[model samples]
Target: MNLNIMGPLAVNELISMDTNLLLAFFIGVGSGFVLESCGFSSSRKLVGVFYGYDTVVLKVFFTGAITAMLGLLFFSLFGWIDLNLVYVNELFLWSTLIGGVVMGAGFITGGFCPGTSFCGAAIGKKDAMVFIIGLFIGVAIFMAGILCGRDYTRPHS
Candidate 1:
């Protein structure tokens, strides 16, 4: 008889908006602290991955992915989480390829992925500040295009 369908917690009425926001704020701060401590705020560290020098980023990400996967599996097996309720985005081949190329180029040239850029900017890195500005501009342009009713999925002929 529960009417709320926004999310698992929302549907169950286990968390209020204020509590959720507080949790998110703490989580974000904790994530930022972890990023800073791990040397993720350095462009040199990130670029080193591409130059075949440092593999810490890859190793950390791989470990995180495996941990998350196993945690999800365990939760599902224990019936603590319903895997069927998870939302999955629809796959688009062309969009995926194009976005990957764009992101890869940005990573190599600017030495900052979106999350790392945020972390770096938080610590007052000039290059990261520029990257953050560019990121916002790109997002604004994309939003404008969406607002203009342009279908991004269709391949331009």
Candidate 2:
């Protein structure tokens, strides 16, 4: 049996590990199936967090974030996970601050974080799908208008 495992990458770098694209696709399918089965792919259920109806959404998310963060820190401390090889998010100071504010606003208004929204969409939530679509289009158009090159394209009499 031949397989490309961790092709061209160190054994510890799972992100760089290689495998069949088909396998990856199936893995995603399995994951989506699990999420759907767990009832995460519902928008109204997610939005219930804001109306004092459900805390499951917020609790699950916070727990997951804390779990992952703690796992990474613990692993790094024990020399299991390589801190140097980990990818750290780039900080464009202004963009990062503004992005965080926008994200927080989304959480407050939509009563769902990005992950929840994605999960909701996966289960065929029409509102989630529309929200996700509009989010992408809005960001795209906003960026286009804000790009510095727009100034040069302005009509000068």
Candidate 3:
């Protein structure tokens, strides 16, 4: 059987710890190699988020959105998953737009989006590592705030 990562990566486990682990590992390595080879891994390429020198990020993001929209439409048509059953977070218009702008600004300033930050860390980019560290800290803080509902949590652990 051709074990695919789509399902397993989503659910947690892969085919087996033996071949599946190696397969997934090498697959990730190979994808990173290709991204770097294609200049997608470079900070320069990411500056498209800023001065218009690059548009790959926008293109990729839009394309992925288009793909997902289409997939959701089709999947709903086929009744694979229920669309109405999915819940959207209560709309915070300001936070949504502000977050998008800040995220895009961060992309321009850091040349590393959230998704690419991990790739940068994987390939030994110091800035990427720092960015990821900051990201984790932010996430931890947010989660602790949500779970504990007070400053007493500290989120040290």
| Per-residue accuracy of model 2 over 109-140 as CA lDDT, tens digit each | 66555556677786677777877876788678
The candidate that achieves the highest TM-score relative to the unseen native structure: 1
Q: Estimate candidate 2's alpha-carbon lDDT, on a 0 to 1 scale.
A: 0.66
Model 1 Cα lDDT, one tens digit per residue, 51-81: 8998779987889789979988887776666
Candidate 1 Cα lDDT to native: 0.83
Query: How high is each candidate's TM-score?
Result: 0.85, 0.64, 0.60
Mark the regions of model 1 whose C-alpha exceeds 4 Å error after superposition. Answer: 1-8, 153-157
Model 2 alpha-carbon miss at residue 130, Å: 1.0
Against the unseen true structure, what C-alpha lDDT does each candidate score?
0.83, 0.66, 0.68
**Model 2 lDDT, residue 14, Cα:** 43
Per-residue CA lDDT of model 3 for 1-35, tens digit only, reads: 53433432323453456776678789888767755
Question: Which has the greatest lDDT?
Answer: 1
